[model samples]
Target: MVEDTQQPQAQNGAQPQVKMQILAQFIRDLSFENAVATKGAPQGEVQPEITVQVSLDARKRGADHQYEVMTKFRVTSSNKSDNTTLFLAELDYGGVFHIEGVPEDQLHPFLMIECPRILFPFVRRIISDLTRDGGFPPFNMDPVDFVALYRQELQRRAQSQQTEAAPAADQRLS
Candidate 1:
């Protein structure tokens, strides 16, 4: 007899059980440029300072429990001395997820954190391959801290809203 390892449903009726499933994953957009590396110069001569930026967005997909999560990456490699750009790579990767039974309060974080975690490895492989095939050493990206990123973005938005509302509050005091 096989022992069942499934988690039992919550005894409390108020908490809705959550289920997350990846429906599809795809490269929504990809662009890679190699300026100096393609010229056949020695690898040491093309030392580049690389910078990467990441962003995430999620939206409803017109069906119940369906959502689309998009992760965007902007990577730039530039020469250290003259600041000439060596390469610029941008990728927009997206996944369709089926999120069911989660509370409204927990939905945002689930989409931002869990969905991206599922899709990151594929995105990482793509970046590595693109850079290697572009005639330079493969660029392996470090793992992203999605939770921290999400928190920082939330704090930024809160601060911006407070800044924008300050004048209105001051007017009411006058």
Candidate 2:
């Protein structure tokens, strides 16, 4: 005689200790452009009329997180009398990260810092690859300080909020 001791009877119960893990990750966008012809006024000279803007953002989607950190090169070289746009290139590099079982306190940092850090190398490689593919030297972006960047963004938002609230306070006084 054999005694069966196994029992399975749980319905609508707490999740069965799901082992949260990254299943898939990948890039979402990438771009590159060469604008020296517009920048140097037909001359083979590299102009200094360019502005580079880098931005980063992250959001949770489904059981994963997504990040978009873009670097834009806006070239405005003056040829004669007009501020002509010699080259305008915007490279938006992004990634989707599968995250699970992350603690609440660590979730924000995981998305804002760790996720971007992981994606940055790939983004840099793509930029260099694209620049070479676009018939130019490899474009290597400088290493980013995400912690500093995050602090700056928070400060800027706080300042903007203060400015917005100042007017309302003034109106109340009048």
Candidate 3:
């Protein structure tokens, strides 16, 4: 018996077939600090407030069709009333993917959005475990909004470029 390797064509047009495979995934770096342990546990009725920050990066490797995508996560929990930090966890997770048939112009967003979407569950689990082991309740991180995150970063870069270009223009006039 032979496997059906051919993919169905789309209704719109002759779009190239898309193929993506996650070759490897890993925790490139991890750290968790329990501030409560260092400073001594709080007195009574500790209310914890948590904040999470996420960033993404992707780069093409030497091998054809292979790219590396990294997701960085930083989590901090603090006492809501006093702003005292309870715990902090930072993780850098990476995945190597073999992607084919995506047009070059669209590759960056694909890596940033889709690849990290695939890696998010594992990243969440690590944080949950990190918090639990660090003597707090298991911290189930909310799912990251990759599309919004990507858009914000793009906006930030555009704003930064405009600022830099304005400075250069002023220098030329002087």
Best candidate, TM-score: 3
Q: List the global CA lDDT of all models.
A: 0.88, 0.56, 0.92
How would you encode candidate 1's per-residue C-alpha lDDT over 54-131 as one tens digit per residue? 999999999999999999999898888667788888999999999998889989999999999889899999999998
Candidate 1 stretches greater than 4 Å from native: 1-11, 37-45
TM-score preference between candidates 1 and 3, better one: 3
lDDT per residue for candidate 3 within 1-174, as digits (tens), equals: 975444444544567888999999999999999989999877777899999999899999999999999999999999987888999999999999999989999999999999999999999999999889988899998888999999999999999999999999999999
Off by over 4 Å in 3: 1-13
- Worst lDDT run of 10 residues, candidate 2, spans 70-79
TM-scores, one per candidate: 0.86, 0.65, 0.89
Model 1, residue 128: C-alpha shift (Å): 0.5
Q: Whole-model lDDT for model 3 versus the true structure?
A: 0.92
Report lDDT (Cα) of residue 82, candidate 1: 68
